[model samples]
Target: MGKAKKFRGLKFKYKVDGINKQLTDKYQTIEEFLEAEFPKNNNPLSPTGDTKIYDVTWNTHKVSINKIVNTLSDLRKVLSVDCYVTNTDIRLEKIKPRELERKSTYSIEQIRELTKEVLFEEDKRNAKVELDGDIIKGNSQRYQTFFTKGIKCVCCGIEGKYFAKEKVYRDKSYHLNLYAVDENGKEVLMTKDHILPKSKGGQDHIDNYQTMCVNCNVAKGNNLED
Candidate 1:
């Protein structure tokens, strides 16, 4: 080798002094600290509880709770608790980057079958449909299939996850509705868009239907696509 490569760029080095003291002083062992921090009832990390930590150091450090847990777990893998506690100059480094989006590994045929199953179920329940002149609307089940299978958006190409049996308050009553959770953790209502809008004399047919997120569909409005 001619020369050793020098690392260059905005390097992020986190000082563990404050966090180490906070963790070490609170509990004698790491196991004790973890147990107290992640309790079953009223836990911050739980779905119902507040996920965010209001610590000044943690906020400034720009590290997630999951990252901290993973770092400690990794340390426990090789070094003993005493060794890790004594090693005050411990550094967290990214050995491998994680994928941004969790995609479904389902095949094309599998997706088709899943979609068909949803449609069949909707038909069995006699799903309500709204008739507007010659245009029959409200085939929500068709679009719900995309959410059920975690399909990507046609416009933004963002993947969505099905959040089943969400209670919706409508007309002074609660009704369960199908919703999809997007990459940003936002709840998205899936909709079936007509390729050719009904306003432009588009027929209400299966061939003309396409799945779209509520946001994208609202943005598209009555604008015809080429």
Candidate 2:
């Protein structure tokens, strides 16, 4: 028996005349495979509709909606295909780019002030610390250390700057942005990463934390350094 075919982590196996064949070889691209497996007519609801549900399947195997969406999203990053999942229906369309607006940069002091006003309550509830061997509610000591040492990506060594933008929705709220400037002076979002990922049994304590740029963190995923 031949090995099963894998597509974006999903396995597809097929048998023909008592012989197993790779199903992935039949399709030229992910877009082709998607169109062939999930035809447009299978979706009765309009593309614009809020609720459009379909039983996603490939041959006799039932595929989860999340798997399909994740596959499509992964493909979009590599391929030129622009698409969005509305429920189970994958709608292929040219996404209009939003206009770029010049965002105001804030000093570390200003950022501290804004964070206190916007996210202080939420952070206070979520953040915890161990005081004299007793776990207590407080801001993360690691975060405090990072702030004091200046926020910077440990991997790339890019210093992070803070910004806050007002939300446009009815209930207006502030959106805090933590961005790092690259060599080319381009701004990239900064993130807090686990030195040893939480999935690998790493604790959410001060010692296990590090600052990372979004791209580096995504590339790292759940991987541990050798």
Q: Let me know the TM-score candidate 2 reaches against the reference structure.
A: 0.42
Question: Per-residue alpha-carbon lDDT of model 2 for 1-226, expressed as tens digits?
Answer: 1222233322333333332322223344445444443323323222222222222233223344343432232333333334333333433222121222323455666656433332223445454433233333334333343554458888878877764332223212223446777778887866667787765677655567677777787688532210
Error of 2 at 154 (Å): 1.0
Q: Which candidate has the top score in TM-score?
A: 2
Q: Score each candidate by Cα lDDT.
A: 0.39, 0.44
**What is candidate 1's lDDT per residue for 1-226, written digit by digit as tens?**
1122121111122224222111212233334433444454543233234233222111112222232433333333323334442354343333221211222232334434434434444352353332222112123445444544346657876544542322212122211233467767776755666678766766655666666777787788732111
What lDDT score is found at residue 195 in candidate 1? 70
**Cand. 1 Cα-lDDT:** 0.39
Clashes (candidate 2)? 0
lDDT value, candidate 2, whole model: 0.44
Model 2 alpha-carbon drift over 4 Å, by segment: 1-104, 116-149, 166-172, 222-226
